[model samples]
Target: MLRFVSFTLAIVAMCNGQIAVERDPVCGTRNGFYGIEGNCDAYVECRDYRSREMQCPDGLHFDPAVAWPNYPCGYPMEVDCAGRGIAQPAQPSAECPHLYGFFPSPKATADECGYYRMCVDGVAVEMACPPGLAFNPSNARCDWPDTVSTCNAAAFLGFTCPPPPVNEIGELIEGPVNYKYEGNCFAFFSCEEGRARLLSCDAGYGFDPISGRCVDGDIIKC
Candidate 1:
């Protein structure tokens, strides 16, 4: 009986290992292999393979549990599929957004997580997000940054002229540099003497130093 019990445990261990190898999404190693952390869903998380802590793949890393495919770079958001900004069931006829206009094949099963498809742009490559994420037509892709907060950051564009140096004139202060938080563009500037300041607008349109060039003080328009 003890011999039989030992054999059963061995079989179970073998099966689990096999599944881990086959289920590995990134690199499929042969029978005696383990996995490491990767952006792709199929990869197993092996912390130390042979003494070295596995670094994140070239373009991938472990994502926070808060977001699916947690390492956020640019994955389509759910709203791209359904017109409404609500989560919808993943269906067979589901169409994905294109990079320029091309997209990957439909998911075989909802469990697949994400898809890898062609980019419509001339890049001629395939991109992917975690399963369930989709491109947003309103913003163009799942990975597009949120614009609302970006737009709000325009408030940061206040005023600061002298460009520092205690009180030096003719310093040829550098023109405003545009810095964006999300989609919004705020001004960033450096003085010729090495001081910096922020530029902003009050009423109508116009920002300090270089006033009223672009409306609404936006560094990036839309």
Candidate 2:
């Protein structure tokens, strides 16, 4: 059976800001993944009494907590580096800050929050969020613009969620609400948690505000 461990060697050196690490004969006793000291992106794999140094891909970190048979490298956002630092330098491009990550498009206008780029292995691929949404860097996913601090939700959405109904004590009563986008018959807004989210219907359908559902385009003239 394989196990995870942190093995350190007495020999160490620092050359040009890179940590030169040497490992002890850990595999001589057992096979497992071993973490290097002070380096979150590097590890030592011991197998059949042989040891090999490995580095996680750019934008990823080695996670020894993961069990064997599963890749130990994971995205930086999901892995906790604790006190360990990343040793590998980043390879960036005009569109990619790192070899792998989601980034906002450089050409996007101040009011345009829908465009983004997905970087993989130093290559960038353009992507677009659904209408009425924006790219959120915090979570690296498309989310309501109102919740994205970098985006101006009111300016991009062109509408705001109305104040919820009030109760007898003047407290707000929260409930889901839907509204039509004035000029676009196929698109509409769904309000939840005081945020207005833009949604769309299928190509052959239109949003019906009265019924609060999508209907055949033939039944509702734009």
TM-score of each: 0.18, 0.66
lDDT of 2 by residue, 108-153 (tens): 5557887898888879999999777798878778888988888888
Poorest stretch of ten by lDDT in candidate 1: 144-153
Model 1 segments more than 4 A misplaced:
1-56, 69-194, 207-222
- The most accurate candidate by TM-score is 2
**Which candidate leads the pack in lDDT?**
2
Residue 5, candidate 1: C-alpha displacement in angstroms: 28
| Model 2: ten consecutive residues of lowest lDDT | 1-10
By how many angstroms RMSD does model 2 differ from the true structure? 11.8
lDDT of each: 0.33, 0.79
Candidate 2 C-alpha error for residue 147, in Å: 2.0
Over 1-222, each residue of candidate 1 has an lDDT whose tens digit, in order, gives: 999998888899898874222233432322222223222312233222222223222222222232322432223332122232222222222233322343433441233323345543223354555322433334434331122222211122222334333326555434444322222334333233332323333445433334424356454343
Instruction: Evaluate model 1: give its TM-score.
Output: 0.18
